[model samples]
Target: MPERFPGCITRVRGISAGHFTDTRRPTGCSVVIARPGAVGGVDVRGAAPGTRETDLLAPANTVSVVHAVLLSGGSAWGLDAAGGVMRWLHGQGLGLDAGSPETPARVPIVPAAVLFDLHVGADPARQPPVCPDAAAGYAACQASLERGALAEGNVGAGAGATVGKMFGMGCAMKGGIGAASVTLDGVTVGALVAVNALGDVRDAQGRLLAGARTADGAALRDTARALLAGEPPAALLAGRNTTIGVIATDAALDKAGACRLATAGHDGLARAINPVHTCADGDTLFALATGQAPAPGPGLNVLAALAAEAVARACVNAVRAAASVQAGALWLPACAQELPVAP
Candidate 1:
């Protein structure tokens, strides 16, 4: 792990409490807000995405200090899980009018994102249309703030996530959430990603890490190549696929800047994943500022590139942390190497 940035850097600590799998085997992951009054913004790239409270990230939105963030399974229906987060935040009096002694106290906002995972072949009862355990994961996020240590891999939102949908669910590989950070000229930029792309996972050097084979381990052409050859890209569906992520920095930025940064961060996803942001892919990125430090002096372009690199690193890490499932297993290339740092 890297050292925390200077000047009141935002400290992140989260965990996966309990997990809920839908009839489609999508897993729910949740995290709590360890710090109060954290500033944030969001960018949505996927045309067919399912989300909750994203409007709060807009510049016109007045609320701040989100109590928690939820990433889960259950497709669009998973949006219901946020109700539990509201319930928890309400109890702590952590919302808008948090300190007031009124019957209707304000609380921290809770924003959530979801991925598709209905084809993993888990028990039907386990793979219901909705998941309440996702809310339990939010409670766990709060508990993890008091408790030390964060758990990763096939837990939380990544619990039931899959990648390389070229052949549909039958050939997708297990993928989950991943995080990474980098320091540029003394400023820190970190990224968190839920790696549920419709394309194959690759290393920084563009080597295929997984998703180019049949379940039986037979080698297949690259998803992009297959698509260009007029083969049916089974994974490229308009409403069924998406990859989501968040970028956090200490720099002071308004919502518009945050949105621009989020757009730039998508370059990282393009670099790390093949055939990204296709008509069938719903890719989104969120940029957040804790407002605890000044922006780097090198200029916004430098910061943008740094943010993009952090996004790429986060995408790679997410793929690396994904656990193998029965339908399709994730495989990192033995010969894969990291990209060389720019001179």
Candidate 2:
């Protein structure tokens, strides 16, 4: 059996996670709530990302902390979910002081990123496109406070996620959410990712975990090999795919350190997913430091390295935990359904 960490982002102090899955369609949103606030930073690698409040996460920005981070599956429209998170935080009186004596108020800072799952499991005849809204975000925030541990696969933002789309949806496989954590020198670093890439996911040994399928959908096509063999890239829907996630730590890191950590998190994606950061994919990562551990002297680099490993493990866990989805004429298979482990 492969090595398993069995750890999640919620293990980090001051962090909580939750999900709100819509039953009408396979679409939903996920929330990572940081009580009080945490120093935040972000890195966007994909060319076609849809995000909100990312500019404020820059190291030079005046606002140094964020209240929460949201990941949703409604494409650009999913960003609205962040507003609901903000509302919830405001109700709890958790945010930056932005008002005076007469109108004292706290403004919650919630940065968000989105993935494209709009084309999956929708009935155009029955209703309009099923996308997550502010209500979904509010519900997710409530779930975070109620559910202590994070749940993975086929839930939240990853509910309708798919991967290995180099040949389009017909040959793609189901993707979902995953989480992992690692402890180093008394500090805990964790990651939670939604795997909705435009390429195949691989194991540490470069073995295909889940990806594009054969024409008959009986086996993996080794998407990288096919493209290297002169297969023309399919005309996939523009900006219709992405992999977004958050990395949380209890280490005492400043805004600049947090930004660097976010960049390092992308290394895990490159290691586990082939052909990442493409024009059609929107890959974004956010980092939060709750400052519960001792300030790093030279151990920051090592901490970042652990974050990368956790991210890679989380990527594998995403697909491995996913269950296949079949909606009338549409069928998206999961790693377990199509590639079972040997008993």
Candidate 3:
């Protein structure tokens, strides 16, 4: 967190993590809406995806200020959890018809994404179906908001996140949600990333900060180098990765500008991730304006640039805040240890 990024709007109210797979594995991360909804846009760069409600964010859509954002494991099946969020938001009366009496109705539009975390090698027949704990986590976030306190690390959507999947899960490292904020001029831009990429993790300088070795200290192969040699093998074709994130700013943006800002924010992902936005990876970025503060500049390009830079800082901070963990036999190192934080 930097002094430049401080602001009264767009505060992270609460964070909740839980396990929602019948596999009894951790794979839930839920973020509650702390700020009033503003304009929203989404940019999906990956070929294979398990996304929910991305179309609603398009410029043609009518909804704004989604009640919640869900990031979880269980692949495409996890999209069902949004129903729970909708039910909760309906209860809060935070939907579109907050005060409309003529046609009072509620729609707690929620956008969600999922990562592939099937119990590989285990009995597929014995594995349980997707659970509703992700929704429970959302409820917990709402509760945490009332009580106060937001926990970080290996929780929520980061529960099953792993990085460096170029050689597959056996060689990947554990990853989780990472947050970073930066202040430029007088506005604050904040980023929260659910890091589950299929490539090696790096810092702003492009160094291989982490995920180059195996859990047992064995040297790992470089997926980037392999791609240069030839096409990826069939075994690596699984939808094993994606990185989902949200960029929050007080600056106002129209639908097109917000979309452009979301695309520009990909630079931050490129800066922090090697071989991003691949066919097997569904990398998406969402630009959100809470309307608490107005865009400082008169032009959309300037505001877009600011949003992009903020996104980049957030991506960098995410890698910096990630913790090292051992999944199965893989030993992932903490981002803080791999790349020292700036002074």
* lDDT tens per residue, model 2, 7-42: 999988899999999998899999998977899999
User: Lowest-scoring 10 consecutive residues by lDDT in candidate 2?
Assistant: 334-343
State which candidate has the highest TM-score.
2
Off by over 4 Å in 2: 1-4, 126-128, 294-298, 338-343
Estimate TM-scores for all models.
0.80, 0.95, 0.81
How many clashes (backbone N, Cα, C below 3 Å) per candidate? Answer: 18, 0, 6
lDDT of 3 by residue, 244-300 (tens): 777666566677666777787787788778778888888878777654553363355
Q: Kindly indicate the candidate among 1 and 2 with the higher lDDT.
A: 2
| Leading candidate by lDDT | 2
Which tens-of-lDDT digit does each residue in 73-132 have in candidate 1? Answer: 656766677777667666766666745455655766777777765555445464354453
Number of the candidate with higher TM-score, 1 or 2? 2
RMSD of model 2, in Å? 2.3
lDDT of 3: 0.61
